[model samples]
Target: MSGSAQVRAWQPGLDGVVEVLHAYFPSHAYPSHTHDAWTILLVDEGVVRYDLDHREHGLTRAQVSLLPPNVPHDGRSVRPEGFRKRVLYLEPDRLGADLIGAAVDQPELLDPVLRRRIEQLHGVLADGREPLEAESRLTLIEQRLRQHLRRQVVRPAAHRDAGVAGRLREVLDAHLPGGITLDEASKLVHADPAYLVRAFSREYGIPPHRYLTGRRVDLARRQLLAGRPAAEVATLAGFYDQSHLTRHFRRMLGVTPSRFARS
Candidate 1:
């Protein structure tokens, strides 16, 4: 329980994730409302009381609440001191259909292992770790959640339009130094945005966004190695600014762009 209350929200730079919220409430309640995305709550301290699917549940620290998309729910502190929590709002398509079904059927999971893994993932994401490393951690977390829920594993059949992935990659490369969005890429390949993301990840082992970011990093590296100014390289590499380029460069390569150039 915290004496004061506060709430902060930010996107995690991942596809299909809406936002994450870190909050501490000493005395607050939420009126019934529905969300278009799934609301996943992780309680860190104290107690949280919420009603879902016409049932009331009191969740304590180390517990998780999985509210499916479009479900009406209300939440508040269960005790006098209130609670601290982290919440993730995810698009329904981000998770497999079967797993989402399992989550809806059993909304609250009381597994310490799952809770700890989720906490770890949050830390890595919040700290701005390497994009590839963060993606790996997130995949592992999803696998563990699926295991805990006892969901069936359904492997995807061979992709019908496997060449579309390659075409999408070509399109991405053609637009570099600028950028192409997921929607734009999907249209070029005549695929749905979600399908394109999954297909690209499966075909190349990285999502489109991460792949595009990596391309930007690769371009930046070359420009830096060629003795170009970091500011010019930022623009040449499709970054918003030098600071933005530096942030991703250091996260991916473990050194600042200038330092890397010096080395």
Candidate 2:
């Protein structure tokens, strides 16, 4: 391991995300290992030389690489300085098994759009506040990845589902503090989960989860101003707990619930 190596890993609240890792290794070599989830990697510094299916590949700054689940792979820095990388370990089903062969054959992609979107998705995932946003981004990224694997042209979907979007919004509003899962919303709205997310985001300025969080924050403010304790206000606002409420509240309002209440 490199003496200067630093790593941060966490499982985000997003259901589609298995885990996220950001690491820097000055000098380390990875032994062969296989993951149950897809490894989506972005190298930000230096270079990574990794072997997938016994073939060596180089991941550089310009590419987003996807290592298929259950593929044995190993990595080490191309230089003495090692490499810095951010990774998203996604659910195995995020991409179908049929594409595994394609991914294994060409794990590194030169698509700038995919790289940018993956970076943005990482940003959304890191916040841990916008599950809907993260899911939406993830869905599109997965779609693009599939297209790449299948050698199809990467293009935007021309269809819109305003009817499904409107119904999903109603479900979200009705569920409120209880909240609903994307799967649940999809089943209830009778639409594909990916379509539900894309449509909701387009119909409303914000994604459903963020919209719900905003509504919860609004309710929280009202309760705080009414002199309720932060803890109680959290429950009343539909947040999981005080800390949960604080995360979104502070992000939206720029102050903690306690501070807001005191003021």
Candidate 3:
């Protein structure tokens, strides 16, 4: 067994955020310590056993865990080939309203959207350049995390809006390229237009029209990367014009579409 281990640290973003990716061989352990920020650990390979809050939990590749600010925890690799994991550290105060009332002490698995968002956040943070992009990426991750935690949970006997929301999202995705009006989206879900507007806003943290526009912009960015001209991509993406697309592209990506595409 190895007598000791070393940790490699990587700082990818301009903000106070930092990523410490660990590779530990058998018998290696993390001594108990605490810090005033959030830590998310995703086990990329092998099994890990850790004691947090005096309770022991076994974690594997498919699982992700959170350590609250100032919580004492210790962990070690249990695999012979050693263990590899990605850890993201974010300041709670910097995160702000993005936490959406989520207590730092609560830990949960990353929902599908959140999983991808967090993954992207890591990718940007891993990049040695583009601290601006990393800051924006981290902000986006916090927003998604908050939305996931705020979603309404239905009881067993309760009527699930799950089916309704799912169906509506399907329709919205189908019409994304062309865009959909608030009334049109409401009709597809068979609910009052006003009620649907509020519900969709609550669920997505954005009105349906804005969400559709954002989706269209996402497509536009891809097209730009594929070598499409800005004007042409703007029209196909359902934007009123190139200037309209430019406004949103800058706001969301921190760069113009043309610049982002090239980068």
Candidate 4:
């Protein structure tokens, strides 16, 4: 441990959120371990190096790291000045299962806007005077994160067969509220993942992941219109939570789920 190292942990008044950590270290190195909840961290100063899924990542003030549940990882300071970080530990189910792949695949995000919003959220949590305000801000933060992770495939090859894409769509529709990975979908259709993505995009005008998300949004719309609570609609439509549902719903329909329900 470094001479200047310090760590603090506390809980916030929010469901599915486990705890928050604020820490500083000069030379301390954390041994590999796993967390039961998702570990989202904001690096406030200096630099930190970590390994997730056998890949190394360096996080700085402009970056955020999102580690999924039960994933083994290790960390240490990357500079002589050490590092300061704020971490939020949330239940694994706080985000949709469909989003986990991206989180695991790319744990660190270099977005200045997201970094600033997270800093503001930390301030609100530390003040402890505006629980609802903090919750709302957190919702937006998660939404931006999901949007960033959602990769868009542009201008797919036109030479692939359209029939295979149609069959894949049918399989996806049959498994609504449940998701199939690109690898799984490829195996089902006897095509490579790259080909499947391009072919799907060419035939449907959207990638498979986006297409499935749209279907879920459609289901959420019907449930909201039938008087179901937004939170319940989120679950029934395969969304991770109400915030997850709201993010996609607003993006697709130009209105939030609550507003859509009322209209």
lDDT of 2 at 162: 60
lDDT by residue for model 4 over 1-263, one digit each (tens)? 34655655456677666676687767667655455567789887888898875678888887888887644567888888778889987777877656666776788888888888888888898898998889888898888877876762223334657788878877787788877888888888898889888877765545778778866875676577567889999999999999999988766544578876664
Ranking of all candidate structures by their TM-score, best first:
2, 4, 1, 3
Better of 2 and 3 by lDDT: 2
What TM-scores do the predictions have? Answer: 0.54, 0.57, 0.47, 0.56
Residue pair clashes in candidate 3: none
Tell me the tens digit of each residue's lDDT in model 1 across 205-238: 4567776777687678667766788999999999
Native-to-model Cα distance after best TM-score fit, residue 141 in candidate 2, in Å: 0.5
Off by over 4 Å in 4: 152-263
lDDT of 2 by residue, 57-154 (tens): 99999999999875567788898878889999888888987787788778999999999999999899778788888889988999999899998333
Each prediction's total of clashing residue pairs, residues at least 3 apart in sequence or on different chains, is 0, 0, 0, 0
Model 4: how far residue 238 lies from native, Å: 35
Q: After superposition, how far is residue 40 of candidate 4 from its true place, in Å?
A: 1.3
Error of 1 at 100 (Å): 4.2
- Name the weakest run of 10 consecutive residues (lDDT summed) in model 1: 152-161
lDDT leader: 2
lDDT score at residue 91, model 2, on the 0-100 scale: 82
